[model samples]
Target: MGEVTINNIQKDESGILKENKKINALEDSVENVEVDGEKYDLTIDGYINMQESEEYTLFLRKSTSGDNYVLTNALLSKYPVEEEEQDELFLEDGESLEETEDLKDTYQELYQEVLKE
Candidate 1:
């Protein structure tokens, strides 16, 4: 294969599609990437375990630098999260009671919208 250009390509189970005029087309393109002089493959499959526990673990795979580390709950609580990235820090799974309550509110709002039909 030739060097993959930074083009807006889409692919599904079939293969890569250069032209996707329709909406909701799959954009799955796995490739090897080099970050901080270390080589790592950007895998689309199983990137995030949706069925797994709510405890998110962010890791830098195959890092040559010593700074590559995993971000656990203990480490997360130690540092004060910046105000700007609040939305990103919010839990998508909502494992705790407080988070669950917020998720419930969002669910109800979405339900109401669906029922309007």
Candidate 2:
């Protein structure tokens, strides 16, 4: 006869997870590095509030689907940063609804008058 035994083990519950409103904001910190006779400071964003034991590496490359660059790193510099535009989308309140309707009617009447002219 064979002996039977059961053992239970618990998993580690410590790790970084993605949060909806708790995204890590990247800080762009460019510094010049002397390589041979030339000096260059890479434009990149530094990670904020990251653990020290985490192992990772930053990557600099062009996006596969678009013409842009991205930087990925943790602390001091890390993550992809893209060039984008900030445009507000809204309607202008130059005229009220009734005034706008009147303007439209006036435009039609003006077109008729011009035709007569």
Best candidate (score: lDDT) = 2
Number of backbone collisions per candidate: 0, 5
Note the Cα lDDT for every prediction shown: 0.30, 0.31
Instruction: Give candidate 1 regions above 4 Å deviation.
Output: 1-21, 25-94
TM-score for predicted model 2 compared with the true structure: 0.18
- Expressed as tens digits, the lDDT of each residue in 50-88 for candidate 1 is 122222112112123342222222112111112223343
Q: Would you estimate the TM-scores of all the predictions?
A: 0.20, 0.18
Worst 10 residues of 1 by lDDT: 73-82
Report the Cα lDDT for residue 86, model 2: 15
- Among all windows of 10 consecutive residues in model 2, the one with the lowest summed lDDT is 1-10
Candidate 2: residue 33 lDDT (0-100): 62
Cα-based RMSD of candidate 2:
24.5
